[model samples]
Target: MKQINTLLESNYQSHPAFNFGPNSWAVSTERLAAFNEVYAAAQQLSPTLDADSRASIRQDLEHALNDIFTAFEAQSTDVYEARFLFELKNACVRLMGEELAWYAGQPRSRFVNLTNKRTRQDTVRLQRDRHFFGRLPEAAAAELRNLAESALGPCRANAAVGRLRREDLSVNSGRTVHALRNVLNREFKSLGVLDAVSAYTGRKTRVTGLALELSVPQATWWKNAIAGLERPPRTLYAHVDETIACPKSIVYLSDVTEQNGPTSCYPGAYEAMQLNPLQEIIGRIVGTVGSQADSPLKEYYAKQYHQSVNSENFRRHFMRLPKCLRFNSHIGWDVLPGSELENELAASEIKMTGPAGTFIAFDGARLLHRGGLMQEGERVALQVIFSDSTFTERAVNKLKRML
Candidate 1:
């Protein structure tokens, strides 16, 4: 990992359009090498792929590295910028989803988990308990399955449909996913994590804040991904960190495109909780996004909007996001020495991203997050989470299971 200070503070300049600071980002070199290998392999495997498929794949990988190079300039200098490692994270997510799916005999599209506790469907269904785990039947599964079957080349068709049909596994007691995993490996002549994806990969790092997992396995991640957005009736919600009797956890999952909008993240802004007060002081360090037009709608005008920039009040209701999306950072603001606010809530109406397979683990206690919407096209992920991972006491993570 290259240090941010050396490259950023040294020889760099900020282009007005992309707002990242002089030294606010960095990415793991290992991640870069992995993508290179995957890119080459993809081209070799599908040299004859259609224009749309080739274009989508090229755009996706191009952004994966381009965003990393851009963010690395700042990540080298700031510890805070380190928290928003979407570049490295999304690289890993894409590899895990696509590469791993191939290793497990499932097609990229067939290997998804949108039923986690984070979906709009779950909030509509999970009344008593918010533990988002296992399988469920719905229109999404049926619709996605049809898409997957049609997407298969002549040789891969039957294999893809078999994987999609497994949604019939019930979610009741002793749901014995192990048996299903074995069957998938046999049918596909592949590895067995069709069950592992449904397993929880992490748990809350702290005890006092929100008690939830960091990265859940498989289909679960997809479920959590979807639940992070806002739609219908509810524009935004207050943090029930305290005073709530039974507050539910949120997560997201992905399909290829806009039909399901995975939460959009404010690039390099994941550590917004480390921010200082809204006084004139912050304007000295970094800037804000959108209408500097000076109305009450300015980015961090909490008093005016009753929330921070991370709040849905500022969410730029997005639809039809390009497959290769890019972000501009806000400048003239400062992240302080210590957390100063009273209600250090997670960001709301914010966005997050991942490719096909990997997961981004977040400290929900330190984030103001939301999944946002399930638009009308293919989405890029699946989101699911373990119970609430926020810590009111705020989980003091000594170490997470996977690091």
Candidate 2:
């Protein structure tokens, strides 16, 4: 692993835009190389395995993709991660073809529990309570499912649709997501989450992006076999929006049963940094796509709006934190710290699981969170990321026709 201090001393002048200081802001070469070794072993798996055995192996590959995403979200650091994800995804397609690969990639259907370190005895009872799904009003779940289906159908026709997997979706896509936007807004307002969001960011926030996620089921054999591999869970990482001052919201659109994928987040992680020093060091870091104005998509948008566009815009508009909070010798902002944060994380962490209308509003730049791997049935949710007026205004104007 390249230490941030060494990286700063060597490359800081040449790559000023390089995010240094925060552990979450820098990539660990050691970790990346380790995952590469695992991928190599995965590539050599036997082809004669049964259906269930194949699914188990593919689940490990899925974690590999998630780890890559956690490493770097900036365009500059994306080539390797992108290549890694493609090869893993292709490995799945090669193993079981596209349809099953897609199924295995869904949130809840994972045959393994790779969220945290555990012994064989630790995960012996990874089953969902049947009653959990029944807790949600069936009518509401049905309504949301209809909305999700309708919302997803048109998006499938989009040029970018293939990029979306069961656990992820592209939010900025316009027309295809309009109805979902309306439905989600109404539901979130009803739940009082938008009010909490406004309070959090101290701004009249608007949804800047929307995504519909689905988590599906897996067979017992698949789960047991994969769990037997005993790979440690991916390290937790947060998605931070440097460009936006507002938080994000995700509303469950289906019964997020225990077996289905739920969101795992570290509560008070933001506040913890207010006191601890060790809490600020020693974790892999990455920037979020929203913060990259120089990115091709953002540049295209800037050109369409007849505005000056460059990577500098990203720094000027988003990265200019107050001097004390900027990446420096003592502290950094928007980072997910290392092991020191784990105990507090254990005490404060929240795993969100609920009925269709369940919702959570959080500071995207402050909180650390990850989408959970599912153990069973479909878990679907709609994510809406809110932001400051400037970014929201751009999104509004750009998505206006579709709305």
Per-residue lDDT of model 2, residues 1-403, tens digit only: 1223332223222333434343323445554444445444543443345668766765754565455435545422444334422332343334333323323321221222234332122222111110011122456556666856765544444424443343333344555466666655665444444444443433444565787754444311111111112332132333333322345666787667556877766544444334111112111111222224544435422321111112333333223221212232111222222223233444555678877777666555455565535666556677767644444566888899777
Q: Write the per-residue lDDT of candidate 1 for residues 146-245, one digit (tens) a residue.
A: 3333222321332234432212211211222233222223321122112122222112211111211112112221221112223211223212111111
Query: What does the lDDT read for residue 19 in candidate 2?
Result: 42
Note the Cα lDDT for every prediction shown. Answer: 0.29, 0.42
Q: For model 1, what is the alpha-carbon lDDT of residue 190?
A: 23
Whole-model alpha-carbon lDDT for candidate 1: 0.29
